[model samples]
Target: MPIEKFAPISRAACIGGGVIGGGWVARFLLAGIDVRLFDPHPDAERIVAEVLANAERAYGLLTSAPLPRRGRLSFCASVAEAVEGAQWVQESVPERLDLKRRVLAEIDAAAPAEALIGSSTSGLKPTDLQEGLTHPGRLFVAHPYNPVYLLPLVEIVGGAQTVPATVERAKAVLDAIGMKGVVIAREIEAFVGDRLLEALWREALWLIKDDICDVETLDDVIRYSFGLRWAQMGLFQTYRIAGGEAGMRHFLAQFGPCLQWPWTKLTDVVDLDDTLVEKIGAQSDAQAAGLSIRELERIRDENLVGIVQALKAGQSGEGWGAGKLLKEFEQRLWAQAGHTAPPVDMKAPLELVETRVSPAWIDYNGHMTEHRYLQVFGDATDALLRRIGVDLAYVEGGHSYYTVETHLRHLDEAKLGEGLVCTTQILATDEKRLHVFHRLHAGPERREIATGEHMLLHVDTSAGRATPAAAQVLSALDAIAAAHAGLERPAAAGRAIGHKARLATPA
Candidate 1:
């Protein structure tokens, strides 16, 4: 369904407040849906609040586009109170079948009859979940991953009594909130994604049991190798690329027989005896030595943001999986806030990038470091490129503008937490080249902090040589250049790096 036609779900209820339940609450609230929550556990409020805090931090770093005003959160005392008047409901109760059955039945009875209910069960079959529900058609499995606000994938599985429209409606709602709904056609125990994850997890446990590798080593095997590839190309496509020019058939022919080998303990179960558990626990503790869980989580979130940004940087046209989702989210945010980029100022520099100094960008002197200045300027340049139609689609067609020269003059220090903006001025442009100037200002005072002069050469990447940019791109550049033609040129446009004053004559 198109995003514009998504059901107007203003209120949602979360039936449980464990990790997954809390994550759902975060996702809903961050997307501007008021949420009512119910959990009998005493610590439920604290737990969910922590999750929401983490979600807010991650979402803040994820996109700059404006989001809707935050939705109100209500903690309800009972399941009935939680679901009352709610347009949508989600059940994240314990995985025990009997417990879920009772909880889901309660929600079904109390929630509006037309409200769609989603189960956050990792392995349970939807058919079992809907067994005795009063409104079985509205119950389906809408499983989300950890840090739900950041990850986009959701598995939507429907049971026998579930109406097809239930799945579609659930998908549309999730899509509206920046999630990708992967529909599962048939009811099965441990649906696709989890099943694959379980296989690897089971094998890792077995490896630990056999003393072949420790927990840390197994993690390294993943994060240092296929894990990176999986972020962009999943298992099959990674192999296809590894197959050289011959592709999947050659890959299958070459390695298909290896599947029968006894290299992995995927089919076997390793007993999690006390000795093994203690050993793994010790190893994990060692791996995270000196770092509190929260600190580690912050580090993890920071790394995730950087990696996702990298993926977004190389995206092409329709873009890659996660990167595409990020862009869609930015677009949705803009649409929700009725935001449009301000028109370029012909007589003044066009503000390209505006961001804050993240704590990570600070150095020993309590200010943002030098290299970060260039990084921020690069991001500003990227913004300019996107605005002028030198985007992923244009680059994917084997054309791109490469920075051939850049000169940065650092004027003043930019301290951590200060907001910064980079403004671009067109210096010159031609069919194959672009010359531009950018000025960085520190805010709330808008004091000039730095300036960069850059020259970019249009390139035909496939030919590995300089080439004329497409007519459309050149036209956009020409228009901007013409608009700024009468403006005063920057005094530092052409500069040399040297001592201008008399060289220590008194000495």
Candidate 2:
């Protein structure tokens, strides 16, 4: 099913607020779904708060697309209270089977009849977890990776008693929240992802025990080699590229015999005695370079943001893999924000974009950098274009407005976390030309901080020449132009830079 068809749930219940549960909370809340959390841990509130903060920071750097308002978070005293009125109930308790079954039973009795129950078990089968539950049909395993808010994949595994509709609903709900849910064919311990990971993990442990490589060296081997290829293309596809003129079939024919090699001892379990444990622990600590867990988490998130953004710009700006999901998610957000042009005031410029200065936008000097200013103006331009019916579909239809010229004047500095608003004025427009001016304001007082004047030319992307826009776009532009015809023109409109030489003052 297409991701855009999915509808976001209104509320969710999170049981057991550990790292995984907190991540689930952050994901739901950021997607604008209210959350009721029940965790007996003394530091549950603090842990969730930190996770949410990190998630928010990563999101700010992840995309320039407008996001929905964050949903409210409430801490409940019991599982029954948390599951009340919740359409989705997630159990992220410990990995023990008995503990998970007990929690699932409590949740099944309290959660709404229509609520879909999910467990964050890494290896336990859904059928085993569903045991002792009143509504086993609605329960399934939704295993997610660490730092769940940033990693988008979720494994959806159904049990023997789980209904088919439950898996479908789980996938749809995950899509609505900007997640990629892959339903397993059948219930199995550790499912797909963990199985793949465990193989490499066992091999790495054996290598360390044999004194072949340290933790940092092993990590470098992955991150600097196949990991990069895997980031954009998975294992099979990477091998396909290795085939050169041929593809996967030829590559497999040439290297398939290597599978019988004795290079890996997958079946041999390593004895993790105290000496081995201490050795691995010391090496791992050295690899960390004394950085705290939170500090390392922030670094990881920033790097992930960069990778995701780079992928989002791939495939000619359409996005690739998880980046493709992000593009669709952003489109949904724009739709929810009401892209249609609203009633024009006829006396003032239209407010098109509202955002805050993200942490990534700051420079070493602690002020928003020069390029970020251009990014904000560009976002404002995109917003204005969308308002006039020039959206993704419009561009895909073969025509778009390209900014031919732009002049920007900066009046003040924009610091991190400061609110920004960009108002656009339709100075003039024709079938093939659009002249607009944008004023950027900062903070609650709405002080003007910058101005951008631009001339955009409508062009047929396929033909590579100027062309008239579609009838719908032209009509929208004409209406807005007529309304603003009587309005005063901006003083900065049509201004050009000029330089004058001055003699130095006499000392």
lDDT of 2 by residue, 1-507 (tens): 433333578899999888899999999999999999999999999999999998887787677676777999999999999999998899999999998989999999999998999999999999998888888999999999988998899999999999988888888899888999999998899999999999999999999999999999999999999889888888888899998888988999999999999989999999999999999999999999999989999889877776776777789999998788888988888766545444546567888777777656678998888887778888888887887888877888899999999999888998876778888888999999999988989988999999998899999999999998999899988988887888898876767775223345559
Worst 10 residues of 1 by lDDT: 333-342
Alpha carbon deviation, residue 193, candidate 2 (Å) = 0.6
lDDT of 1 by residue, 60-105 (tens): 5565555666789999999999999987899999889999999998
Per-candidate local distance difference test? 0.83, 0.88
What local lDDT score does residue 201 receive in model 1, on the 0 to 100 scale? 87
Per-residue lDDT for 103 in model 1?
91
Off by over 4 Å in 1: 1-5, 316-318, 339-354, 357-507
* Top candidate (lDDT): 2
Which 10 residues in a row give candidate 2 its minimum summed lDDT? 497-506
Model 1, residue 169: C-alpha shift (Å): 1.2
